[model samples]
Target chain A: MECLEVYAWLQAYLDSGVTAEQERAVEAHIRACPYCRRKLVAMARVVNALERTSDISPRADFTRRLYEALEEEAGHPLAPRPREPRR
Target chain B: MDLRLLERCRQGHLEAFGDLVSRYQSRIHTLAYRMLHSREEAEDVTQETFLNVYRALGTFQGERFSPWIYKIASNLCLDFLRRRRHSTVSLNAPIGPEGDIPREIADETQLPEDVALAGALGLDVQRAIDALPPKYRTVIVLRHIEDLTYEEIAEIMVLPLGTVKTRLFRAREILRVSLARSD
Candidate 1:
């Protein structure tokens, strides 16, 4: 595949969702081209960075706050039910 | 996503609903926070999502409640973004050159030490996500941060599968360019 096509399909190639033929073509192109290879590495770094994004927690009283909002919207508060054990 | 909790919620038990809230509040909040990049807005969006979900409990017939909840949360995030855009004057005109989607990539040195809850690299990536337009941001958040499938993302975004795939690929490409420029 050409460099531009390789660039276009690079994300899918990294995502492992590309067609086999496209994958082979991209792999060959990257092997032959430094710029595309650099793009691939950078793209991979970006994807890896996404997986590393830390979970953002709500406030300490998130549940209480949500219930308060719900209580206001719902006009009445519900009681907590017995939670079923997870399998 | 608990059927029993949902059933109890449908029966008008506030306690059952609270239990359901306990289950989803964190995940939903996380989704909102990632999408909005604002803790305050994220909190509001999370609360709004649960409120909408609670109000619509009787209408939800799906087996897994996650998709439905995610749909509501994402839509709310979009609405909030729209309102935010309309109300505020943008100090920065535009950033991304390749596309219309406004990309936000924060300078690492500029980021305060405290904001790097996910470390500098991770927070840099999150800032990149924050800069994405609402549509692209939603897809990236759902597919990457929230770890939902593309099909699930398509459902949440209410778009065709091909469109979602194309958008996601384009968004990744934009992110790639943004990161490449930074380096």
Candidate 2:
């Protein structure tokens, strides 16, 4: 029963949206169940790290270069269309 | 900025095409960069994505442009990843323009230590994500970083709801395991 509850809430917990009551219950369960606790921590850690990671913004001239490339491609007679036939 | 410009672009108004590129270029490039983890490939994919978008603009329904453009980019990335898998070449190794690599910037919000930790973690996370199968990686990126809902991911990937959820869960677990091993 407890495992079922944990499994159900695991994704939500990783997403950092577990309700207060649910968080309390899950933490209690983790304290008593080493296996579940380890799995929970690992999952939580990955998510936490991901959320904390720095965003690498693209180059300063990204937009300008994209336009240049798009213009170049748009001028082409053979640019690949979404529905174009493939060999 | 407006759909009418897109319409004009679709009608071969060159300036309107420039407008459309201005509007979506950043988004398309960012998506490509995140998916492929290589700036050069991302640039190539971004160019290709817009070329396809321009050609298909006439067929686009009055629906949201966000999902439409993303759908195109996602499909292209998937195909590229699949083709990469067939070859013995390693994509993880950097292959791009010489001496034009973008410098990594430290965020103002992060102190020295936090910035370092963030960079380290981000590199590992990206590596793990790159190692994932294209299908799983696509869903994960769309759902997590792109902040699309399950339904949206389903639409983007053209998969059923169950498959999207299953792939997302498995992708997260795979990332977790890979990151743990790296630690």
Candidate 3:
């Protein structure tokens, strides 16, 4: 496989989405070509870094703040307001 | 989608809407944060997303809830980015005496091992992502971060499937070059 073909299939190869025949071709190219192999490894590292990155949570009071904003937007208490003593 | 919860939400149950908010708040917040790279703005987007969802509940006709909510959150994030384009700082801007990129605040809930691993490389990866153009950034975030399918990304972005795939490929290529250079 040429360099362009290798680039074209690199993602699919990493995803394991390529067919067995295509995989073999790509693998053969990588085994034979040092430059392509380094490129593949670097690309794989990028993918790994991305996949391993943590999914961050919002701040601790996110839920409370969100509810407060929602209530304000709704123009009413999210929960029923306490009734005044019987007039 | 909890049909019962959705039905209650559609019927004007505030608690049910709150339930939906609690269920999706984290994912929505994460998407917003990744897209905009600002906690304050991400929080704003998350809040607005649920509010929009609440208002539009009546119009929802039993379509899948996750993608619908994601669509709203993504649009809000995009709008925020567009409005801030003039003032936005490059994520690669040097920080500290050694000129390292700024690290995102760590998530306490993440696994210790993952957090440690991330501490080493996460900031670099984030900088690379932030350097991407918005179109490429959107696909990368949707696919890698949110784990959405290309089809779902197309629907959310209102683009064709082929466009989504092509954009994603281009995005990865850019990421690859950027990451390689950083190393």
Candidate 4:
């Protein structure tokens, strides 16, 4: 495969979603081509950085604050439901 | 999605609504944060999202709840970004009592000291992401951070799958070149 073709399919190839025949062709091309190989490495680094970035939590009182805002909008206390109907 | 909780919510069970909030707050908050790049704004968006979710629960007829929640949150975040387009805030600006930056508040999984020590590179990556246009940023955050599939992202963004794929490819290419420049 030529460099343009490889570039077009690089993401799918790296993600391993490409067909087996396509994967083999891309792998063979990368093996023979140093430039394409370097491109792959660079792209891989970018993906790795993204994947390694941890999911961040909001502040300690995230739930509390959210509940409070919800209550204010609700205009009534968001208390647990009573088991029986209040006549 | 918890069908039981949804059913209870539809039945006017306040506790079930609370349960839904507890289950999705983190993810919805993270999505807002990544899209807006501001903790305060993200928190506001999260609150608004759940509130809207609660208000609209009666009309919800979808099999899954996640995409619906994300769709609401994404719209709110995008609107927030659009309104604040001219005014720019430093991502390093103090956002908490302890004087932590938005990025620091984002990754609370790490100790303060560890975040301080190793946060430079992470901050660079975030900066590159922040620099992306809102369209690209939304798809990248949904695809990578939220781990949503292309079809789900397309659904949430209300775009064609081909558009989502094209935008994601462009977003990654932008990140690649931006990070390379930073190095």
Name the top lDDT candidate.
4
- TM-score of each candidate? 0.85, 0.71, 0.82, 0.83
Off by over 4 Å in 2: A2-5, A16-32, A53-57, A60-65, A73-87, B1-20, B89-121
**Candidates ranked, most accurate by lDDT first:** 4, 1, 3, 2
Candidate 1 lDDT at B72 equals 94
RMSD of each: 3.8, 9.8, 7.8, 7.9
For candidate 1, give the docking quality class from DockQ: acceptable
Name the better of 1 and 3 by lDDT: 1
Comparing candidate 1 with candidate 2, which one achieves the higher lDDT? 1
Report the number of the highest-DockQ candidate.
1
Off by over 4 Å in 1: A81-87, B12-15, B92-121
Clashes of each: 6, 0, 0, 0
Enumerate the candidates' DockQ scores in order: 0.44, 0.20, 0.29, 0.32
Task: Name the TM-score of chain A in model 1.
Answer: 0.83
lDDT of 4 by residue, A1-87 (tens): 689877757777766668988888888999999988887888789877777655556666766776777788879887762222111
Tell me the tens digit of each residue's lDDT in model 3 across A1-87.
Answer: 578877767777876768998898899999999988888888787777777655566666777777777778878778632221111
Error of 3 at B138 (Å): 0.8
Q: Largest TM-score belongs to which candidate?
A: 1
Tell me which residue pairs clash in candidate 4: none
Q: Candidate 1's residue-wise lDDT over B57-88, tens digit each?
A: 88887887778899999999989888987898
